[model samples]
Target chain A: MQRTPFYQKHLDAGAKMVDFAGWEMPIHYGSQLQEHKQVRSDAGMFDVSHMVVLDLQGAEAKPYLLKLLANNVDKLKESGKALYSCMLNEQGGVIDDLIVYYLSDTAYRIVVNAGTREKDLAWMRQQLQGFDATLTERSDLAMLAVQGPNARAKVFSLMPADEIAIAELLKPFYGAQIGSWFIARTGYTGEDGFEMMFPAEQAEKVWDALVGAGIPPIGLGARDTLRLEAGMNLYGTDMDETTSALTSGLGWTIAWEPANRDFIGRQALEAEKAVGVQQKFVGLVLEGKGVLRSHMKVTCEAGEGEITSGTFSPSLGLAIALARVPVACGEQCSIEIRGKLYPAKVVKPVFVRQGQSVLS
Target chain B: MSNVPANLKYADSHEWILDQGDGTVTIGITDHAQALLGDLVFVELPEVGAQLTAGDECGVVESVKAASDIYAPVSGEVIEINHALEDSPELVNSDPYAAGWIFKLKLDSTAELTGLLTANAYSELVAAEA
Candidate 1:
């Protein structure tokens, strides 16, 4: 299994290591519950070095991205602006969901999932036939996400004086270069924080500084629960290459306006939209005993569906899930667990945001 | 180091059986088992008066990581179950030996006791696995 630059730090901190997408990653420092609560309550840091970062440079970079991603890249007018989009196949199926940063007129940075790196790269390369953009995967950089309510404050405390001003001025979904690092005011946990990418060799030094600043080191186990609570869709579990963004609660990422923008998968999405989407992604809260689990059956008056991702929310102290159900499904359904059906309340996919419950 | 009380009898599957000395015994998962499973989010216990045999899957413990079956160490009928686990499964992580006990089984025969390992033997087993 591959190990990140901070592997030794994780080992020294007594992390429970597990194999995640071929990487020997920390599942938890000790107690996953404690780590999750720490992120929700105060501040926590995650070593996300396994995620691949690719830099696209050339005069045609903007046009290349426009044809490649489902979301319109033209919306990124300001430098350092980030756009969350899905690279789709001709069938409108999501190849991968990613965040692209508009660094400059001819350069952009894209962060893709670790597991889908090779496939995503191959797809991007295949689509680069007519485009003049060059894609370079930056394996030399390590990524860290500092999250939760006090995450920014704790990170600022450790930043150099000159970088602090730039970091403080960064708006949501925007990034800026600070010193030798690129810090983005974006996160997966629906919390206020920055995802910083820097030279891999400096990972330990930065990690130690964050730890000294009282930012607890969290692992992938809590990271999953935190993102789930925030209603963020995991790449594989929530949606994969066979799933479309329309049915995966990501329709908002699709740009349908300016009808003349002939992006890949536009025809299929338009066709699907015309035919009407049959399945809708919805959030579920278990009203009865039992924890919701992925692949579990969900039944309602309209039809049956399956849970895409499920977990016990640490903040809500209840089992919650994201399920793809028939569009006619009502606000109440039942989830099958261990051969028994338990009632569940259907709600919007987002359960929490900004460290507070958004569910009614 | 995982805690293994010297007085309790252990099963190879990591369940602990405490003989109450009244033909009834309390059963629960070991600290090692709970630790491996991470935080327990839910637990399903067998109903009272349910007949169970040795090695039979009598209950389930679901943690955030995965779900595992809790087997009956020795065959008997369940006399009582820890209903409190329905709302607070973390008790298994907090106190696996005492308050987290899953059920009280009325043993069919005391002769089954000899099949279980002593605390020292169980400690060796856990150490070997680690």
Candidate 2:
């Protein structure tokens, strides 16, 4: 199994390790529930070094991305600006969900999931045929995500004063560079934090610094729950190459304002918009004594749907799940738990944001 | 980890069997099982007075992460169950070694208990699985 720079740190912290997407990663530390609650209530850090970082260089990078991504890249002009886009198949189904950063006029940085690294890289390279783009895979970089309300203050305390000044004013979905280190005000856990990228060789020192600063080393178990509570989607579980962004609660990332700018999946999405869609993603809370789990059947008065991701929500103190079911499925529903169906209530996701319950 | 109470016999599956000693055995999941499940969100206990064969699935323990079945280590009649788990399942996590015991059974064939691995063996089993 491949190991990241923080593998030893995770081991020293008494983490339970698992093979994830070919990388040996911490699944949890001690108790998953305790770690899940810690990230929700306090602060945490994640070694997301397994995620692939690809840099696009060459004058035609912008136009290349315009033709490649479902979301437009025209809005990103300033250096360090980040845009969340879905790389879709020709049929409008998502290939992978990723974040692209505008590093320079002729350069951009993209971070993708570890599982889809090879496929995403191959697809991007194949599409760069006409463009003068040079795709540089930065396997030598390590990513660390410091997340939660206090993440900024904790991380800023460890950063050099000059970088902290620029980082302090960084708006969401934006980033700034400090030499080779790229710190972006973005994260998967739906919290205010920076997904910082630094040289692989220097990552252990930064991790030690964060450790001394009181950021608990978090694992993938907490990562999953945090993202669920924040109402974000997991790439494979929530939406994969078989699902489209429109039905996956990712329509916000679609740029339709510039109607004239045609992107790769625009035509297929337009067709779906015209004909309407069968399924819509929604959040669910179990009303009975059952914890919702992924792939559990969700039956509403209108139709049935399957849970993409489900777990006992630490923030809500109840079993919560995200399901993709027929559209217009209403308030009351049932989740099949162990052959028997139990009651639940459907609601919009975003259970918690900024450490507070969005729904009361 | 549940006390494994010196009086009760356990299966490697994480179930504990309490010998009611009158040709009957009381069965339930162990504290280790409950802790592994986490946040006892749900319990699908078997029906009272239901007959079960050794190794037959009797019920389920559902946690926030996933669901696992509670198996019958010995064949018997399920005489009683903890209905309290249906309302507040956290007892399984809080006092699984004691009050969290799942169900009671009247042994049909005591021979089934022989196949079960002891508490010490079960502990080793979990450690090895990890």
Candidate number with greatest lDDT: 1
Q: Model 1: per-residue lDDT, tens digit, A9-91?
A: 99999999999889999999989989988999899999999999999999999899989999999998898999999999999
Measured against the true structure, the TM-scores of the candidates, in listed sequence, are 0.98, 0.92
Clashes of each: 0, 0
lDDT of 2 at A150: 87
lDDT of 1 by residue, B4-27 (tens): 999999999999999999999999
Off by over 4 Å in 2: B1-7, B22-26, B30-40, B83-96, B109-111, B119-130
**Highest-DockQ candidate:** 1
lDDT of 1 at A8: 99
- Provide the DockQ value for model 1: 0.81
Per-residue CA lDDT of candidate 2, range B6-110, in tens?
Answer: 666888788887776688876677777776665567788899879988889988887766789989888888888998888777788887766777888888777
Let me know the TM-score candidate 2 reaches against the reference structure. Answer: 0.92
